[model samples]
Target chain A: GAGVSQSPRYKVAKRGQDVALRCDPISGHVSLFWYQQALGQGPEFLTYFQNEAQLDKSGLPSDRFFAERPEGSVSTLKIQRTQQEDSAVYLCASSPGGGTGDTQYFGPGTRLTVL
Target chain B: QQPVQSPQAVILREGEDAVINCSSSKALYSVHWYRQKHGEAPVFLMILLKGGEQKGHEKISASFNEKKQQSSLYLTASQLSYSGTYFCGTETDYKLSFGAGTTVTVRA
Candidate 1:
């Protein structure tokens, strides 16, 4: 089976421009999560979705960030007015069950560079 | 808050062993281990619940101590493939707080 995947492996954007990153979770996965990883640091939680409902978004850094899982499969993370500080790798993960304890499978990630 | 990992980095030789530890200040519901290489996504290694049961996968294993809010990852007879940054995620609720990460460099 295909694992979780993300599009636009690399993206370079000008500061203040808006950018969107896409993620395709494993088929039939009920839980999806997004994380942001800075260079030489651990990934920080961004948001999470259970099916079509986003269960949590507390990890989102600011109002400029938005995410959606419309059909409970594919998800997108959008950043408005990107800043140089927003330049980092965005990772998506999914698990078979909705439980938080479930093991999550990760995607290759999309590296966003804001200039 | 994020957990703390000991020994920011370690260098080892094939067939040697090493231990990576993770400690959290808050009560944890679960602890997850992941290994990530440069320019790649993190790969899940194992998960240990609050029960403190020790689990193993191949030559790698882990122990979770609920009482101490700490976990230890053991790499026995380490392989070159084990060379990567290891992160421990502590789950107090639905979200996981990951540590700074411990880099393991294994030489042949």
Candidate 2:
């Protein structure tokens, strides 16, 4: 079976430009999460979804960030205005159950570089 | 808040053993472990719930101490494949806060 996957693998955006990153979680996973990893640091949580419901967005750093998991499958994280500080690896993960304690399988992240 | 991991990094030879520890100040519902190599996503290692249960995967095992709000990961007889960064995610509710990470280097 295919594991979770993210698109573009890498993205370079100019400051002030808007960028959208995509994530495809493993088949039948009901819970999906987004995280940001700065260089030499641990991943920081961003948002979470269960099916089509955006259950938690407290981890989102700012209002400029938005995420949607319509139809309970594919998910997208959109940044309205890219900033130099936004440069980091965007990781997506999914688990078999709705609980956050479930073992999460991760995707090869989309590394975003803001120039 | 993110959990605190000890000994920011470690170096070991094949067949050696190492221990990585994670502790949180607040009560924890669960603790999750992950290992990641450079330029790759974090791979799940295991999970320990609040009951202080211990679990193992291959030669890697972990124990959760509910009262102390701490967890320890034991890597026995290390392999080259074990060289990577290990992160512990402390969960209080619906989301997890991860630690700074501990890097492990194994030589054969």
Candidate 3:
């Protein structure tokens, strides 16, 4: 079975540009999450979705960041006005269940560099 | 809040042992451990639910102390394959707040 995957493995954007990162979760996964990893740091939670519902966005840093899982499968994280601080690897993960203990399968991630 | 990982980094030779610790300020429902090599996504290692359960995989094991809001990962007879950044994700509700990470380097 294919694991979770993200598109545009690497993206370089100019500051102030808007970028959209895509995630394809493992088939039939019900829980999805997005995270950001800065260089030499651990992954920081960004947002999460259970099926089609955006249950938690508290981790999102600002209003410019938006995410959606319209059909309860695929998801996207969009950043408006990309900033130098936004440069990092964007990771997407999914689990079969919504339980906190469920092991999450992570995608390779999309590295975004703002110049 | 993000959990704090101890020792920041460690270096070991084959057949040595190492321990990585994670501590949080708030009570936790569960703690998840993951390892990430350079240029790769984090790989799930194990999950420790509340109640101080201990779990093991191969030579790697973990213990969760619910009362202290802390968890530790122990690697015995370490191998070069174990070299990577270890992260502990503390779950409060449904979200996981991860620690800064502990980097482990193993040499022959």
lDDT of 1 by residue, B33-94 (tens): 99999999999999999898999999999999999999999999999999999999998766
Candidate 3, chain B, TM-score (2 decimals) = 0.99
lDDT of 2 by residue, B1-108 (tens): 889998799999999999999999989989999999999999999999889899999999999998999999999999999999999999877588899999999999
Give the fraction of reference interface contacts each candidate recovers.
0.72, 0.79, 0.74
* Candidate 3 CAPRI classification by DockQ: medium
lDDT of 3 by residue, A8-115 (tens): 899999999999999999999999999999999999999999999999998899999999999999999999999999999999999999877888889999999999
Candidate 3 regions with alpha-carbon error over 4 angstroms: none
lDDT of 3 by residue, B17-77 (tens): 9999999999999999999999999999999999999999999999999999999999999
Q: Find the 10 residues in a row with the least total lDDT in model 2 chain A.
A: A95-104
Q: After superposition, how far is residue B16 of candidate 1 from its true place, in Å?
A: 1.0
DockQ of each: 0.81, 0.81, 0.80
Give the per-residue lDDT of model 1 (tens digit) for A52-111.
Answer: 999999999999999999999999999999999999999999999988688888999999
lDDT of 3 at A111: 100
